[model samples]
Target chain A: MTVLDEIETCIPALRRYAHALLRDREGAEDLVQDCLERAVARRTLWRGDGPVRAWLFRILLNRFRDVRRSAEGRAQLVPLDATVEPARSGGQEAHLDLREVHAAMGRLPFDQRAALLLVALEGMSLAEAARVLDIPEGTLTSRLARARETLRRMTGRAPAQDLVERK
Target chain B: MSDNLPIDDEALIRLRHGEPADREKLADLLAADPSLRERLAEWDRQDAALATLYNPLADEPVPARHQDLLAAAARAPGWRFRWPERIAAAMAFLAIGTVAGWFAALHQMPGPAEADLATEAMRAYATYSVEVLHPVEVPASAASHLESWLSKRVGRPITPPDLSGNGFRLLGGRVLPDSQGTAALMLYENDLGQRLALYVAPAPAGVETAFRFAQSGAAQGFWWVDNRLGCALVGDLPHDALRKLSLSAYDQIDQT
Candidate 1:
């Protein structure tokens, strides 16, 4: 496939991933568009050493981090209630609800959430996800384990017998 | 059957994703342990929940804007020359020569090498001031953060002078990549929407601190080297007005 075609195919996945990260549909789309423009403009920089998909994700993530840092400067402008996901309450539930899982995902640290999404939502392999995140595979694995453990606890899916281990 | 398993989290994660190299060993363990099976199922459920939440976004038709962008990019020639960026760069180089020559003629002194820094500022001002969308990487509203960030990158404590008294409010600032380490450009705008920029970079040690003036096209600049910092104050305003702002800006930035 041409580089543009490869990039085109990744757009939907990019949109999904951006939406998951930003939790704002319009903002996510804008971010994806910006990322696509950048990737195209700098297409010459894309060495055939890695999958174009990973490079695109890396660009999107870098853009996301820039937007986030700028957002941090104007923190008061963001409504606290709107951004904070409500913690899922109550004891162990037998099934995980999508909304609950999403809110729990939001509560995950950015690193952990990013790792989890690459592995789970995008179905990228551990090594591929690590490349996208620019982290060691062992670090990504640990983040995933921590993310799942946190998700289970927040969604009240932690096995009853496992409660004693919880501090 | 206990929560403890011989496999590490990495092996278990691989198994849950069905990429385990030792499938036979894991399968035997799963057969002996319902808990391990349950754990794998839980991972499956979590992935399913995430997929349910986000997959529809992918399934939805691609937005027109995205499709349009891809199409436009595809239509572009492989070896395209971006005229706007090229024009800006050419104008900058021209400004450098014009300013350097002016310093040589008007001052009766050999053109200071720092005049190039002045025109670099002019170039930055010309390029970014016309930018409607992203004139500055960090907006002026984040003044404190912008200051500290630029200061760290430029390797000099930079305080963007308050120019409100001179009918200009700070618009924002950005760190510029320079051949000599880095420079910081702080943009300011007047009520008429005219912009002025202050470019600051670390000067070479023992450099003369002579103040200088240079102009190119509609843009004029007043620049100087003081206390190991090279600074240029650039704008399209007339000579006297731009000179006035530059002196005060020099004073304010010099104190830092």
Candidate 2:
């Protein structure tokens, strides 16, 4: 199969990832479709050296960033539906509490969220993600650290502890 | 307690790496401090919620029309501004026409096969196009389910074409019969109103090695034989444009 054909198979996964990241179904699919078209048109120039999936993802993430940057002043959050129940039962009432978390996630600077999601959701290794994001590994680590801290504070979680215990 | 706390940046970096040993160390540190434990629990809750929010959206069905649109767009012709290439495309059509005439002269007694096949394909195309309420026996949105269902009916394993790159998404496929016998007609469309149909059947005896193109009124018909399968791509587009679409369809079907 041609590289174009191989890239076609990755669309569903790309769409899913984009949708999750954008939280808008139509916008996410459009981004993935556009990315696929760009990839296909550039297939001849593609070096076939790196993982195609990662390369496609990088294109997608970059497109998302561009859109986010251009629409900075116009960005609006979709209010979470209060009626939907949490997936799991917990005394903390994760469903109600999660709206705040989602908002906080949106509020995070794009680089931090991209780094955090690349690791936590997409399951990319730190090095792989750093390569995809075109940043130094140290930079990725710092972004992830800041992201977690921001999330912790937003969720009303206490600060990190200093106690140590031997394993 | 304060002295025992591992630095926040270090612990977070470790957690992102999925280092369980670091988590254990952090957990130990948090356990000694009530406020830190509470914070860690909150972070865990946030992760859980984020996962929940995104996971289900991935499984939701992409609208059928979007799949159709992508499929159609992929088949659209590439931009060409050069006169020589346009002339070459014209010559290709003339060559195909000449070949068709030669075949017609050789056969003398024309059978209804070509006409019948084109009509069947075009009819199936039109039927599916207007089908506002159930165009395909199996919708492409449930691709896995459609694969199994169409395969069972056709008595052969069939994989749907991946047209995402062409801007055409597989909306799924269905089995339809023509005057000739059982045929599989896969429906695909694009954001534009264009739609392409793939008509497949076992090749008739002795007629297993010919590539034929027929323009039926406004629609273009492409038929070819590869081993035992008779494949045709019928669509309402220019002949050269149709060939490119047929080639893509052939690539997709042949791979499957």
Candidate 3:
């Protein structure tokens, strides 16, 4: 497949991750669009040695951080913890307490939330996630640990698990 | 249950995978430790919940804005401003202005407020003009949803501004959030495949509406803030070519 086509396949995942992080569908779409613009703009800077999805994820994250920092220009603080509705699904999936999960997520610091989302939601390997976040694998592990602990404490339920997560 | 072995991330991973060796060890060490198994089940359920929450976005249709961004990046030489082409554009603008009175305004630099609106309009143009597949969230066919959704989000009544008289067709719009409340980006396309975007955001309270225009390397735009909204019309067409189109859109919005 062509590069743009490959990028399209990753778009949904990018949107999901962005929405989960930003908790705004429109903002997440804009974030994903910006990420696509940068990837297609600077595709040359990205070495093919690594996964393109990872690179796109990296850019989306950096752009998100840039917006966050600029918005926090020491004036009116934009609340990053806006209440979010988790993915809306029907039927058998109705049992999931998405609101509870979303509320728990709102309380997490950005780093831990990001780490947890990458590992659990996106199923990234520890090494891959570490590379994406520009942190060491050990640090990524500790972040996950802290995130899980925090979620457990806040939710008063079995913490969100990273099922089938790889090392 | 026997050994009170502490569970680390590594141990949890093994248990999650149900590695036979770990299972056998668990069988021997803590024969009835249902707690570990129960924890694993929670993790599985949470993972499933997240998968359900986020996995569906991929199925949602791709927007025209994203497709255009991808195509434009692929078509461009680079993301940097093309200075030589821009100089050529200046020459062309003068040539066109001599023939059509409207091009003269294209040469003027944008004021601060107009500059902000123009840049957003340019962004809207870059995001929607080149799209083919899904260029709109609510297509023109479903004008009511498009209208109501945009109106609600933008905190103002919005009728899809008409441009058929100017040869551009409505392709619908999406609401974008801003510091104040929200902004509406409505897209239009002429027969030649040139797309235009009409972006509407509320002006800071107390700002009155006026007819204003601005231009940049990417696209030239005309913007005004009525007592209720700050409106901009953007497209890749030269300013002279877009004047009639912009005016037509303004007229429709004025009625609104």
Candidate 4:
């Protein structure tokens, strides 16, 4: 496929990943736009060794980091209430539960959230996610475990007995 | 079945590798553990919500403006030209100069070199102009220091040209290398959010030049080579405004 076609195919996934990271629709779309532009500009430099999706994710992550770092002092956390919309299905309780999950996601440290999203949301293999994150596979597993624990506690869910049994 | 949890790192590896037996063991362990079930459920919900949250963006049409920007970038003169092709083309053209008609043909062909330079200059301007943090190597606030530093690097006694009369305040200056050689780029901006870039590089010996104007996309550029230096002024301003800026910059730099 042409570079532009490959980029177009990846946009949906990129948007999904960015939205999870930022928790704001506009912010996520803007980050995707920037990532696409950078990738298009540097297409000649792209070596086809790694999966293009992984490379695109790496670029999106880097751009997000740069934006966050530069906005560090002035950054404001988006309130959970602001992120939820009126449910088209009229299931207010389910919507509220979703909002709680999102807020819990926001409370986790960035790395853990990134790991969970890559594994659970994006369905990337542990090895591919590790490569995208520039971390060892073992580290990824441990982070995923910690993230799962934090998320369960935040959501008021019981600790999984598998974890206790393993310990 | 207690060992089904894959607690040992090796068993965990087997499970990750999608070994069927290990997968069943892991699933059974999660099924037997309430806490594990809750945690897994939470992860599943989070994933579902995220998938739904960003689904709209996929169908939301890519902006026509952004597509136009990409198209223009693709059509840019130097986009497909590798360094070797550029050098070879330059050499071939120069060699063809031995034939009278070929030399004239070479002179008549628009090289697009100036347009490429202008594009680079405007891109650099746009990138640095909007930055609230770390705008330039030297801020225009310290005009003297910026001038001296850039001048030392470019091997010219440079000064930030006074553009107060033209409503543009000197923003700052930086040194950038182009195909021609190392050049000095000075940035300027007005209150109206318009930015201008002036690039000066030493001219080859005895190459007398004339003022030339060219446009690329939204930007207009004016270029000339004086006895000592080749200079270009680039911006999105109208032709008259760009010409006026170029003249003002030339007058100031010449006096120095």
Which of the two candidates, 1 or 4, achieves a greater lDDT against the reference? 1
- Candidate 2 residue-wise lDDT, A81-159, digit = tens: 3322222222344433667667767667667777777776666777678767867678888888777777665554433
Weakest lDDT window of 10 consecutive positions for candidate 4 chain B: B79-88
What is the per-residue lDDT of model 3 for residues B1-256, given as tens digits with 9 covering 90 to 100? Answer: 3556567655564443333665577556434667666655556666676677777876687788987777765566742324234433433554465513443343333346644766776777787767788777888766667888898988789988656535677888877765446888888887677888888887665554344557777688777665567788888787776765665565456545
Q: How close to the true structure is residue A29 of candidate 3, measured as C-alpha lDDT? A: 91
Off by over 4 Å in 3: A74-96, A158-167, B1-4, B9-33, B77-256
Rank candidates, DockQ, best first: 1, 4, 3, 2
Interface RMSD of each: 9.2, 8.8, 12.0, 10.3
The list of candidate 2 runs beyond 4 A from truth reads: A1-9, A44-48, A68-96, A160-167, B1-5, B18-42, B63-256
Ranking by lDDT: 1, 3, 4, 2
Which window of ten consecutive residues has the lowest lDDT sum in model 4 chain A?
A: A84-93
> For model 3, what share of native contacts is present?
0.32
User: Which scores greater on TM-score, model 1 or model 3?
Assistant: 1
DockQ by candidate, in order: 0.30, 0.14, 0.15, 0.15
Q: Is the docking of candidate 1 incorrect, acceptable, medium or high quality?
A: acceptable
How big is the positional error of residue A32 in model 4, measured in Å on the Cα after superposition? Answer: 1.6
lDDT of 1 by residue, A82-112 (tens): 2343244534344588778887887777788
The residue-level lDDT of candidate 1 at A99 comes to 79
Task: Please tell me which predicted candidate would have the highest DockQ against the true structure.
Answer: 1
Error of 4 at A33 (Å): 1.9
